[model samples]
Target: MIIEPRSVAIIGASNDQDSVGYALVKNTMSARCDVFLVNPNHEEIEGKKCYPSVKDIPYEVEAAIIAVPAKVVPDVLKECGEKKVKYVYIISAGFAEAGNVDLQDKLVSIANRYGVKIVGPNCLGLMRPGYVNATFAPYEPKSGGIGFISQSGALVDAMVDMAKESYGFSAIVSVGNSAMLDITDFIEVLDQDEKTKVIAIYMESIKDGREFINVVKKAKKPVVVLKSGKSERGAKTALTHTGKLATDYSVYRGAFRQAGAIEVNTFTELFSVSVLMELVGEVDDMVVVTNAGGGAVLASDYAEKYGVDLIDLRKETIRRLDKVLPEHYSRQNPLDIIGDATSERYWKALDILMKEKYVKSAFVIVTPQLMTDVDNIAMVVAKIKQKYKKPIVCSFIGGSRVKNAIHYL
Candidate 1:
């Protein structure tokens, strides 16, 4: 079953509080996961007595979490197989990445024999807020709505922070090394999850490439991806370690298009797209409002590249804009208010466009100069947003002020 498993086991359990295993245990337990510890060396960890092996554990293991050394992983899985553990998560590093191809092959072989499902051979592990205990860092995420799958362990933690601080998520997991389990597996699983409204993924490659395309194509919810290894070196690292073929980025791009998934460039894009996925009713139409012509021009360029139409203002809309904006600034798709625009102009333009049938989304570009008061503009925009239900995105380009605002908003 690709859904969340109720029971779980932790292999390579440790006594060191500072260790990744310790953190994994702490976070998952915080989420109220039905956790069972298996560490022969320790009598108990964090008040829970440890089992010596998966075989020694009393309950049936639904999922197995491994956090021990890389070399000992096969033996652990062997024990898991003996105990009939269905799912195995390996957080130890040292295989193809350590230039040990044979080791990676052996692990894969062992897993396939017993029909073992693996998450990572060298990684921080999975964390699904909706599922049981996570194997990420010490901090577990509070269950919410969105589901996330990341490739890097560190990035997974970073995204966890963003998920909690920004738009909340349902779960988080890392598909490190992707020996047996992979991005597709999680995507296919989240595909059916009721809690998963939005999916933000950090992936380098997909194992079953064709099936990956099919899953996203069939997915009703939006999938936001920040794919790394766009370059040759990056593609190499993504492929060699995960046992996945890092094909041309163009192929993946085309696949995403065919699958109807939105590809993002940065974490900001990932979150913004997902947030917009909920806030906006339709994505094809957008209105670009800016006081700076250059800023409007750049926004138009971005819109053109994405195939998103930026609509021109209606005649009445132009008349309204002309009452407030400078005479030189034309009433066009960008609706540039020019440099001399007052606070009233900003709010007025927003109100007029918010009512427009063609404008499903709004992009506000602000480049404040000597005459422009950033706070004054933000206040006007925020007020206008409060008035309108349509989703509005603010781009404070060309300054740290906007970057600061971007993060805050």
Candidate 2:
């Protein structure tokens, strides 16, 4: 079931200052759901009375977070079964990845018998904005339309810290070991979710190749994947990390393409594409407008590299630019307005370009110059964005001077 729980129970709620149990409870304090603490060692934790087990809590919980030791995870799952919790997030480690495959199997079997959906056997848990922040990660992700699933918990931690302000998430999950539920499971659920508009994945290995491909193919929303372990050494490392052999990189790449999903190579590209996919929607083609000649060239190169075609302007479009731009203007696809150009020039050029029937989208590239008003240009771009049906992306290129302008856009 994909329903957000109305109440949650943390099985290993702890009082220790430096423990995952404490982190889970502390982080989830801001959740909208009613939280019940469970730990036999303490009567209370963080001002809430701690119960010995899930069965002992007077109020029934929709979800149970089993954070106890791996050896006792089965017993905790048994108690959760007796209480009839529908969802489980296993935050504890030392299961399959640690060579304790039998224990992990038993844990999944019990949850299955009780009809409980498990998120992880070893993971950092999950975060669903406006509902719960069940992760041990310190920062809470802002609510947005992007849904991210990752195998590496630390990378998720880094993404949460770095992209928290700029990028938002409808849901975020870290799938460790994935004994019961894996990356494809989350993808299937998120694909059907009304809250998610785009899905992003960071996978070291695939759980079920056929199921993963089929789901991605049938998804109505955009799916972006960043698969690690491209090299032989990296594949070996992946096996050691997740206890699952990494699929051949070439086969996975072909599958992603056939599934109509965007496959990115680096973490940087993953976020870049995901943010655009979520906010701007998809564009089959784009045009570039720039004040700096170098920036225009770079944009053109990348546009071609990413298989986005730049539209050729009609003779009438060139005639329109001739009247507004400098006499020496290049008048090409990368419509280069001269260096000392003002916001008014950019506004006029963009207005002309956007009116063309073929220009589906645009990228506004600006470099800091002595006469450049980065902030003013950004303001003009933002306003023009609202006036068009096409998506507009800005590449405000520079260091400290352009930071505010980039943020403004």
Measured with C-alpha atoms, the lDDT of residue 251 in candidate 1 is 87
Error of 1 at 127 (Å): 1.5
Candidate 2: where is the Cα deviation over 4 Å? 1-3, 292-297, 304-309, 312-332, 337-344, 368-376, 400-404
Name the candidate that leads on TM-score: 2
Candidate 2 residue-pair clash tally = 0
In model 1, where do residues sit more than 4 Å from their true spots?
1-4, 17-19, 69-72, 78-84, 96-116, 129-133, 136-146, 157-168, 243-245, 257-260, 266-282, 312-326, 369-376, 397-409
lDDT of each: 0.75, 0.85
Model 1: per-residue Cα lDDT over 1-409, one tens digit each: 4336667888766768778788767766654446788888888988888988889988887888888887788899888888887877788888766677788778889888988877777766656665665565645566766678887888777766666656766667778777777788788788688887778898888877799988887777778888888889988877666655577899888888777777889988887777666555235568888878888888888776555678766788788777866678757888787877656777878887887776777888878767766666778777777777667778877666566555555
Q: What lDDT, from 0 to 1, does candidate 1 have?
A: 0.75
User: What does candidate 2's lDDT look like per residue over 1-409, in tens digits?
Assistant: 4436788898898889799899988988888888899999999998989998899999978888878888899999988988989888898888878788888889889988988888778788768877888878878878889999999887889999988788889888888888888988888889888889899999999877788889888888899889999899999898777777787899898778677778888988998899988988767657788888988888888776555678887899899989999998888888889899888999999998887777889989898889898899999888878888689988888999899998877
